[model samples]
Target: MLNDRYDNPLTTRSQSARDAYVEGVDSILSANGDGIGLLQGAVQADDSFALAHAALARALQISARGAEAVAAITKARALAAGISGRERGHINMLGHLIDGDGALAYAAALDHLAAFPRDALIAQPLTGVFGLIGFSGLSGREAEQLAFLAQLAPHYGEDWWFGTQFAFAQIEVGQADRALQTIECALERNPCSAHGAHVRAHIHYERGETEAGLAYLGEWRRDYQRRGVLYCHISWHVALWMLERGDAAAAWRIIDDCVRPGKVWGPPLNVLTDTASFLHRAELMGGAPQPERWREVSEFARQLFPKPGIAFADVHAALAHAMSGETDALAKLIAEPVGPAGEVVAALAQVFAAFARQDWTESIALLAPVMATHERIGGSRAQRDLLEFSLVAALLKAGRPDDARLTLISRRPKKVGARAVAGL
Candidate 1:
């Protein structure tokens, strides 16, 4: 038996397998390339390595390779019988998450963390504002995320990766100064870390420090490898700040160069959401890109048309269909019932559809009641602001200038250059 970097026991009997698994985990925490090849390579070196199988499954799930994820995890579970309890916990946690059972995943992760506090893999699902618990209907999610990290802080003393994770959690829960301090420590430790850059971008986004965010990301992102997982997302953040500063051209350039048809960062769903959401808002700013661009996005989105599982993806899918004038497809999507969060998704779908048709009154009506619950869609506040932007745009277009003003003021601390993006 061997232990991972976190001192969690592994069932692997091969030293080569252990080395590959450790490298894969490190790559994952660094938000670098998929690391799937390394994880799979570990299992190839030792087919009975349950942890490697589980890790590969988790990576597959993240990339939206659902069939492969299921097969991999099934193999992991079959081989996990003789593993240590903590290693078994990894298989269980990945199982729950891949099945979309977020609550069960969070519980398994928490239980695993209690016994292996430094297991970054297990800690990951419990630490972020958008982690398993964050998506599990937990209240005070950001606070809860911070509290969980606080407990594990001692276990990860001076770990640069942990520092970046901690900083982002702080930023999410309104501890801007602390986030800055923590992120500075992380960057000092590893300036090329995509995790550090991602957190630093979020910190700047929170404080409305648009210029600083742009400068920081511009300098750092130039050296960022295209293979990094955060490549598209970090570029998305850059586009956001550029939009804030009324530089739509620069923002679109980021979208075209980094996030679109060229690269593979993570899941297609993530890229689709960022591209479609950005374009939806860009159009509102009177800077509509080429119609062919919307058609390209719409075509990609159409492949997952009727089975939009996640609310966040569903809304963006709606944006794609609506913008492409695929009214029939959009109608069908609205009619289909998703799960508990379906109402919010359906309402948002209608909101975008209405906005596309210039039916401002309909857009306002559909978006207003569901506005408060937008967080349930499972994205960062910056991402969820797309909904608010849509509503405000509707309010103004509908001749309700006063309501639009109120909505704008309500978004406290304000979004960098969002007013310019919305033409407010």
Candidate 2:
């Protein structure tokens, strides 16, 4: 029996196969290196490596290679019969996710971890805000995510991958000071870590350190390959900071090059949501989001997400549809929303629609109450700023400057530097 880097027993007897599996897992976890490529190499070196096949499927699914991922997972299930219990459970959980069974996947992850805590691959899906637990649409999700990572912390001290995730969990729960230090530790251990750089970017954004966030992330990402899992998202942070600093030109350039639809390599969820969010935020700042840009994003959303299940992406899709005058698409989401957070997503859709209609009063009324529970929409607080800024813009537009100022003061005290809203 060979052991992985995490000291978990592997059924693969080949050292080379084991080595590739270890590197592949590290790559996907950090969003650096060639995770899928290396996982394929692992399967090639040992065709009977059930864990490697399962892991390959996970990486493929993350990259949004749906058909290939299905094929890989099918192979993994076929090979699962003779493997260890840990291997069987690992495949099962990932199978659940690939089958679009988030609830089952989440439950299976917990069950798997109770026995094999060091199964970092099995645990990866449970770590981040975009993970199963974060998008579970449950209330107190931020606190829930932090507590889940906290429980797994002792098992993974000083591990760079786990450190970045733990640090982000803390950041989302309003623990900026503590998160800064943890992310620093992770970055120190793995300077090329894409996830490490991303978590640090979120910390800077949370604390209203726009200049520092831009300077640090801008330089760090210069060397990151564009195809890396987090490249478009990290670039979104840079564009956000540029907009904050009143450099709308630079921000739009970043959007055109990296964050826009068909412009960069990224998950469709990220491509659509980031494009819609950035364009709307730019619009709030009084920058013109061209008609063509809105149409492209709306069409992209329609093609990729004709129906909605993921609330985070759904709300953004609704924004694109509303802005592009895709009334039929918008009406469908409003009429029949489905998911735990479907209603929240529907309300957000209505908010965007009203904003598009320039009916500020209606938008404000619809948006205000949802702010209390917008965490159900999923995504980090920084990512959710689209809603916060949307509310501010609505207040400002509705001839309510005082209310807008009060909203900023009560909700985002530290982030009150930039003036993106009209008449504020």
Candidate 3:
């Protein structure tokens, strides 16, 4: 029955409906809320459907109901038992979702590939898992997984679904130029591919090409609108770039657009938190404390934490407190070991503390390692670039122009908008 949903010559009507359902599923995955109501109706009509269950599980997961997602996936697995081919690949996707370890999931995906080699659906999740682990620079297993993906690309064709994964791996490995080329190639092959456009935007944004990055977002927005999909994170990326460029007003505009009331498939809190953080930072940069927004952002940050541990939320919380001049609050917040995100927040808090004390040397020393580590891990490139710019400002204040120049030169193509370049 599950196999009939994907491929069955005899059940023409069933096959047509299933094809439309799969398209709806992909649209929902890409952040289309309009399809969810339709999908809900389709699932109700076919209760024994594994594909419907999988799609519902994905939709629920994006909506932030993890427990409900687990239930849906359980039903999917049971119904998928007699399925084969592409339908089995969908089951493997549920496995990837259940397993938190990206490297392990990628390995398991490869084992599934032995039985279904030519399935593009299988390649999509495998690529995402590899990119997740690869971006963290976790050696050995991540490297092997990425290499396997790169090898798989040529066999599948240059325009394969894994192309963006290869580009992201290149970026993580510090080959930004190559990453740009790879994405450009992918876009050339399929101009309408949102995946290619998204990757290209990241490449440009990370390299400090703010105007180019924004243009890519425009392109992506057109493509997304045409397809009735949404890129929720793109607004945050644009806001961060504007903030880094010292355009507080422009940044706030992006934030406003992000949180404007709308029907959305995923949890709207992600963008809400981003808008709050950007507002808090912009207020601080403008030399006024936004007390109300500070509280709002902090509350959202708290809500965002205690889950998969969003690194940005922790750093934003610490920064919000620091901007409000709540030194004690900042100190207490950074004390928790929230993994990579906490480390970043702690480093920033130390800088803010030193700055408050008018101790320039201490501030420079505190920010050095934080900047280095974030640059390596592909942390928000916009944020890292701005931090490097701030480091130069701190160094100049400390009368250390030589060190500032060295730091400026090390970031290369990303040095364009950096305040450090002015010091050079």
Superposed on all Cα atoms, the candidates' RMSDs to the truth, in angstroms, are 2.7, 1.0, 4.9
Per-residue C-alpha lDDT of model 2 across residues 303-401, encoded as one tens digit per residue: 998778889989999999999999999998999998889999999999989989999999999999999989998899988989999999988888888
Q: Candidate 2: TM-score?
A: 0.98
Task: Give the TM-score of each candidate.
Answer: 0.89, 0.98, 0.74
Count clashing residue pairs per candidate.
1, 0, 0
Candidate 1, pairs of clashing residues: 244-417
In the range 1-424, model 3's lDDT, one tens digit per residue, is: 3232224221113544465566656444334434555556556666666666776776665566678777877887887666555565656665576544555656666776665554444455545321344334432433554576676765556652456667765665557898888877767766655556666777876676877777667556644642233355566666666665667677666565554224232244444445544554353344355666665555555555534234444555565555556666677756764543455666776776675565779988898777655532323354344466666656866888777667667765465453323334
RMSD of 2: 1.0
- lDDT per model vs. reference: 0.78, 0.90, 0.56
- How much is 361 displaced in model 3, in angstroms? 2.7
TM-score of 1: 0.89
Residue 74 deviation, candidate 1, in Å? 2.9
Which digits, one per residue and each the tens of the lDDT, describe model 1 over residues 1-424?
6888777778878999999998888777776754789998899999999889888887777666899999999999998778877778778888898887877887888888788788788777665545664554434566777888888899988788899989988887779999999999988987777888888888887788888889999888888777677788888888877877788888988898888754555457668888887787777677755678778888877775457656667778888888888888688668984854677677777887887788988888888888765766667767777887777778887888878878867764456245633546
Name model 1 segments beyond 4 Å from true. Answer: 127-130, 137-140, 262-265, 416-418
Scored by lDDT, the top model is 2
Error of 3 at 87 (Å): 4.9
Per TM-score, the best of the predicted structures is 2
